[model samples]
Target: MPTAPALSILDRSRTRSSGSDADAVRATVRRAQRVEALGVDGFWVAEHHGVPGVVGSAPTVLLAAVAAATTRLRVGTAGVMLPNHRPFVVAEQVATLAALHPGRVEVGVGRSPGFTAPVRRALGAPASADADERLAELLDWLRGRGPVTLRPQVPAPPVWLLATGEGLRTAARLGLPAVVGGRLLRDVEPLRRYRREHPGGRVGLLIDVVVADDAEAARRELLPQAVALARARSRGEFGPLPTPGEAAAAVGSAGLTGRERADVERYLADAVAGTPGQVRQRLQEVLDRTGADELLVASTPYDEDVEAANDARLAALVPELVGGLRTAG
Candidate 1:
């Protein structure tokens, strides 16, 4: 099997109760620099709007900040929702960032469901039905195949599709690289089909991970973040996601009580939560299962203290994982 590339960090900060938005952005920038110093390959920003806990509404803006702060870490959006904005505008934004950052910019595009009903309605795109077509149009515009010219002569940034299940098939048909998360119920068959059909594209997998000295503590801290994700997905706030209690738990204690926590623990055992050694083993298992060429680690914290600890753990884990993989090879 081909050894996977070095792991990359994607900053998906859950909105904390105390920190202001500026504080969170600055903190994210600091963390980006720290991770860069530790030899991470890249950093990705997510786009989430109208969510109380998610502050990364504009990934390009955040990526620009990250670009200015760090010298070597490649920066990009894990994706920009295509259907919500004009293709020309997105092309220009991405092109401008790439020009400013030179060869260090990557553009991952997706059709997002925004965050809330009001926000989606405000954007004038309440559904993702036309996202694929919009993405295709955007690609054409970026590649200079469209009739209208995208000025400023921006070289197209490498575009990656955030795909799941049949979405992978569409990505393959378009000959684009894909970044897939584990929320889809289907096996790696989508990836296999993508490779078999396209033969020239690439695939990256995103996994929620928390590696620390205390395994149970890490899981406890990660539960709220997982729960938030579950609720968001169930409401169709984002793309498809793993059913709650299957790989994650609810964030708040609305229905889940003491007994519920135990059940959640049992349900989420296979999730990537544990000590460094155990987390590494779980990652390897995921790799074996999917044969993904790249992995994006999304680490979250239930609170400030846990966030700091998780960041430190990630700082230590990156080099160790990369070095071990290299040595083993």
Candidate 2:
């Protein structure tokens, strides 16, 4: 059997209803410091423009903080949305970070547009922008194949694609590693096909995971994120996470429609939340199903102390998953 996969964290800088957006960003940096001490492999931040629930709109900027605060943790974006910016600029930002951090920075790119039409307009991203073309352009600049050489010409950081359906094809075609999550995980055929086509390209599974003393405690920690997602689907706006008590009240409130309740349940069902033993079993099953090379935990609970404890437990549970499970093939 293949060895256990490497483990990493992707913090979305998810805002809590009790805190401001600035607090969330600072918390992400602090969390990076804590997790680096915990001996995890890598720490990544995300980019989400105009989302109430997320404050990580500038991943490169945030990663710089994370990289500086931690001596050993591999820090990167998960990622910078290709459609929202010029490829040359993105390359410059990544190259700058790599020059400063040396062998510690990784770059993940995605094709997702702004969260809403107005946000997209503000970003000047057209509805029909060619993300594949933009991704190719970004790769060209990063590889020194563009018309103008990328400045500060340091070694290009490793690049990953955040794979959805089209993204899976793009990553396979380009022979790049893919970070896949959500609904994509429910079907293993695409993941299998990607590995087959790329012939040993790395596959990283991104999922919501919370670890606590027992199953129910972990579920409570996961509830706020689930509630945020459910509200996003029903109300068309993803707001900051509520506390566990707030989430429970919201779940049971008469104001919550049946559809919203169903959405919350569905989101919770998709996550992996339990005691260490249960999480380990669930993670092993996911790895077996997807043949993944790495695991990226994407859960950001409402409480920082609880989140820190969760990270510690997760690191302890999967000691073998800390680093160097398998290299990108």
Candidate 3:
């Protein structure tokens, strides 16, 4: 296994009340450059529409910008919601991106309706359509089994499934990499099952992380975003994400008390928030339990108030996490 945490940026634009779309885009591009300068391995742009805060509706377009701006960091989608798009269109777009960047793209696929119902309806489908089948069809198109050929004919980027359980099984059967999130690691059973079933390939683990001097303060800033996201995800809101107003209403109606909300947020942070020592220990525990070949850290600095300060804190935490991985190895 590599000693360093395979770093990647999860760009959500992170709009404050005063920020505009241009401001968010500029921040994302600048942060992409900075993350590459930090020796991070790659950057993954998310795709969400209808959401005011997240400006990454077209992750490929944003990735093109990142690719033009940076020299080394790999660029691709953490995922593109396959069900919302036709297979051929997605295949061509990704192929064109690969043609431009060449071996620097990683495609992560997920089933979640990362957007709202109206958006899904606008795309000509119900949000509850079978994503697994759509993913299989997309994979088939990428593999050149479809009757229509994607032009430019770039090699297929490495495909990854952003799930566990049967999704991992699908990846194994298809001979693709699978990315397991920290939230799903309740036990080693899934990982063990994946390894046993997928002896030929590797598994990638993604953890939500925020490293700062004041853990409490970090949590305060990060919790609202995480809670909002978790609520959306749990309710199957896919495509472009819901507006903040929409998200707020959903979360508010869930009947969670202030303390319950706080507790869930903290729990979400456990995957990736704390001092260097704390993060290092937690990462090691995850590795021992999961046997993941690569670990991807999704560092969420949700709070805008401490954005600059948290950037520095994360920069300081990187080497420690890397070194600790080396030591543990």
- Give the Cα error of residue 172 in candidate 3, in Å: 1.6
Write candidate 3's Cα lDDT for 257-287 as tens digits: 5655665565665556666677667766766
lDDT of 1 by residue, 82-164 (tens): 87777778888887888788889999988655446677778776465488778988888888888888765678888999888
Better model by TM-score: candidate 2 vs candidate 3 = 2
Candidate closer to the true structure by lDDT (higher is better), 2 or 3: 2
> Could you say which candidate leads in lDDT?
2
- Which residue pairs show collisions in model 3? 49-240, 113-237, 113-238, 114-238, 115-238, 115-239, 115-240, 209-272, 210-272
Distance from true location, Cα of 262 in model 2, Å? 1.1
Per-model TM-score, in order, reads 0.83, 0.95, 0.81
CA lDDT of each prediction against the hidden true structure: 0.70, 0.86, 0.66
In terms of TM-score, the best-performing candidate is 2
Q: Which whole-number lDDT from 0 to 100 does residue 310 have in model 1?
A: 71
Who is ahead in lDDT, 1 or 3? 1
Which 10 consecutive positions of candidate 1 have the poorest summed lDDT? 320-329
